[model samples]
Target: MTIADKGPRTRPFEANWLARIGWLLLALYVVYAGAQLGFSWQRFSDGLGQGGKFIARMFPPNFTRWELLMSGIVESLQIAVLSTVVGIVISLPVGLLAARNLMPAWVTWPARGFIALCRSFHPIIVAILFVKAVGFGALAGILALIIASIGFISKLFAEAIEEISLKQVEAVRATGAGFTHILIMGVQPQVLPRFIGFAAYQLDSNLRNSTMVGIVGGGGIGATLFTAYQRFDYDFVLAMLIVIVAMIMVAEIVTGWARKVFQ
Candidate 1:
């Protein structure tokens, strides 16, 4: 071997001084920002005292308004299920169209733009708009959640489609299959499980969001909880909070089960 053939020796690992300095600067900025926000020990101490009293008032939550609670819960469930279905149906086509690897620029651009518009506003803001436009109710909540679902699931579906093996799609095409047939045989099989998983997640998210949308007059358990809060019905508020927490936990369990089943 010629001496000139060997490259210079180098360390196997080296520290990045720039990253370390950046991290130090970030830490310093956080401290500076906190100081600027007027963080003080005395205010924290006072907050703790208030928190204790608030907890004391929340014990032994009232559940006497079972009928009202049940109605709200049922409405929320309906919103979640219906919105998930509508979103899944719509997202499938849009997502397929948006996949850059599968579609031309003309197709992907419009599909992507639509998804971006849907996601531009938070669901709460969308709910507020629908509430004002539709004059408030479960309809508004459902519409808002449907938009949210479409915005979210469509993006995932597009990316999933993009990541699929083009070789499989080409193989289907080799048999002189039409576009629809190629998509069904090559793409749908790859992404169906993922689509199901995303749908389950969206349903769970919709259930939680449905409760909050009602606070803005969109209709659900949130409306009842908001009313209880306005009336200073602390015990009932506590009961509602507990129920919401339980509902969310149950949804998490169900979604986990669904993902496993589909996987």
Candidate 2:
């Protein structure tokens, strides 16, 4: 074996064979999926005209139905606040129970399982179920979003707790502080900021979900939007959509302020 005969030991721009093969497979799958989904350049081009007409119809949004809009908006706000408060309250204990470091295996297992169950269905699906069970209304929407908030916030809260520095907790324990005292004095402080941030984020998410839950008879602006859509009153639909957007924007602002306050 002469050095020259070894072909400089390696080639420049060496390829990752596994990566290349993976990319090739992904490209093939994307093409297959696109074809199956009826995605085509011509179809997209043709849709643009319809989209323009729809946008035109949406302009000069009819807000003559101000009372209807206000009522739905108020209901959505109520649902968002009630769900968020309930979810935050429930999540605090559930998150503490789910913390692997702070809790026993028996405790964490059930807590984690409950959170998973809450997350198993989308809010809309849950709302539908609630409607089916309760015969439709804002109460159904409130319950659906509370479950969603618990699932999302509890998971995040547990993860945040796990990520917290344990040195403070250990120091408190060394002082013979009881478990409850340690959790109160040590653990809560470390996690409170993150907890608040999570709560605020969940509240914002619930606001958006509250709007949609109404479509499934959960009650809110979504019902109005759906009705307008069914009636082909796109101007009214536009009005509903604008209100929803404004509501969401206000929530975002509030949560943003809250997140900053906590952090």
Q: Number of the top candidate by lDDT?
A: 2
- lDDT for 101 in candidate 2 is 88
**Tens-place lDDT digits, model 2, residues 133-221:** 88888999999999999999999999999998899999999999998999898899999998888888898899999989989999988
TM-score of each: 0.90, 0.91
- Over the stretch 182-243, how does candidate 1's per-residue lDDT look in tens digits? 98998999998998888988888898898899989888898999998899788899998888
Model 1 residue 207 lDDT score? 89
The global C-alpha lDDT for each of the candidates, from Candidate 1 onward, is 0.91, 0.92
Weakest ten-residue segment in model 2 by summed lDDT: 6-15
User: Best TM-score goes to which candidate?
Assistant: 2
**How many Å off is the CA of 41 in candidate 2?**
3.7
